[model samples]
Target: MHSIGLIGGTFDRFHAGHHSLLLAGLEKCQKLEVWMTSDRLVQAKDSRILSWDERAAELLNFIGEDLSSSLSINSLEDNVGPAPTHSEAGAIICTSETRANCEEINLQRQKNGLGVLEIIQAEYVEAHDGKPISSSRIRAGEIDSEGNSWIPKNSRQGVITLTKEIESKLKDPFGILCEGPEDDLSVAILGALEVAGDGASPIIGVGDVTILGLQLVGINADIGLIDEKTQRQKWHGYDDINQSNFDNILNCINPPGKLTPSLLDACEIAMVNYHNDESTLIIVDGEEDLAPLFLHPLAPIGSVVLYGQPHRGVVLRLTGIDSKTRCRRLLNAFSSE
Candidate 1:
């Protein structure tokens, strides 16, 4: 066995694939040094990517039980990390995407008058849909770390009722409540925005008031859903909100307390547009109160979903794994017909 083996990656969301890669390296070497890409590098690609400490802590927790003594996790600041210059490094484990970089490392080692290190290929893990599982895919709400989709098949095919059995759970805020007087809506909107943060992946507004407040403040959402009513009554002058501001406008008939197939279709389309860097406005013919149930699961990680609570305030939900899991569970409780 090699004295020491090296493995490096962003390792953003520790998954079965990451597990396999680490194990692959450990089998061929006495010790494995895992170099995790720094948060500074990952943020440029997806701000929703977990920080170094958060990712490292979770990774260590997973492998700490039996592999603690054989593993050493370090932050990778640059592309090659220390692989090119490290004196004691023996072999490097890499995925298909990073194989070329490993070869380049050997070239650098040759120039440094050092022997070439072995480049071992790691096992690849695929999601249920036969695609490789990736952090970007998980962040997009396509699949979980185990490669399972959060959305159950055929769940969106028909109308799903928000039954009274789960009404209390629905009423409970899934996110923080930013309370404010109705007259001065800015207080609540601004407060929620602070929590949402400027670095949030995508800001989505799911109510007429929430969309309006965002528009009036010039901080437009990547996707906005509006039913043109508030508190089960006509939001007077809802038309005053500009439709031209959005790159595309889609309409869906999502009756009060019901998630229609059309609503699901519209949301999926909006998410596609969001990926394409286009802004969308989904105008609902019925109430949009229950829309959050779908938004949390459909949105990518780091997305901020905002909706207004009549006489209360704006609710801002930072979409993440926990929120997505909760949404999936809540969706399972819906009565489909």
Candidate 2:
């Protein structure tokens, strides 16, 4: 019914909620002017935010060339951009979070001797967990773009065994292999430290060598999984790993080639307290090698998970969409009880 409706947001990780907002504008307006936050402006909120061009491209891809004429993406320098002064903008679409700002924009428009714009509040999109889907949550690695949670709801109740059929695939490295000498693991540890420097949330260290090397270099992982073994043999220097350094010490039985519910529960507990940043150490009774398969999906996007590769050295794995998906696929391949 409106000629030109305006919608504004960062749309950084574009999720189901973003799509719904866009849909609300398209349904009521012939043309929608989407004011997206500029890269520089959004950086203060989250430095990992995609560039303006990248965000625009995602918008264009979703709206498609056929509807391109109906949609326009403008850079948002501030909360209200040209909206208060624009005589042509007849209506504005926003979420409940921004409703107050839109109301203020209308008051400013009236002050400018322009017609008051109609404000439409878009419905929220909820994730599988029944919470509102948001870019911030997506960034935290809780759910996918479609609002699907990366961690399965009923998955924490069973034991998943890495069968021989999938063992060959598991042998292949899932992340960056920082190859170095066993005697001097400085290169590999430093490599992981560099990755951690990128501001990933809740850096997880798995395996004895990986944690020991990081500890020696004074790099404390937000969460560490250790079994006091390297290459299926007990490492004599595991006593060097200071247990008191971690605030919480969790113990679970995750035998070799199998991931247990106890282990998953521990990961969930640790992650739920991510905001507090309570550093945790999970001392497994068995192998922690297979833990990464679950850790990737549970940790938020941009999370760093480090583990050793036997004679090869350390593997620096940063959890992202592709890596999380791959980890889920491998997780499904496991024979579960």
- Report lDDT (CA) for all predictions: 0.87, 0.84
Worst 10 residues of 1 by lDDT: 148-157
Which pairs clash (backbone N, Cα, C closer than 3 Å) in model 2? 140-300, 141-300
- On the 0 to 100 scale, the lDDT of residue 10 in model 2 is 94
For candidate 2, what is the lDDT?
A: 0.84
Give TM-scores for every candidate, taking all chains together and pairing residue i with residue i.
0.92, 0.95
Q: After TM-score superposition, what is the CA distance of residue 282 in candidate 2 from its true location, in Å? A: 0.6
- lDDT (C-alpha) at residue 265 in model 2: 85
Candidate 1 lDDT by residue in tens digits, 213-304: 88877778889999888888898859878889999999999998888888888988999999999999999999878887778888888789
Deviation in angstroms for 235 in model 1?
2.7
Candidate 1, pairs of clashing residues: none
Off by over 4 Å in 2: 195-200
**Model 1 residue 181 lDDT score:** 84
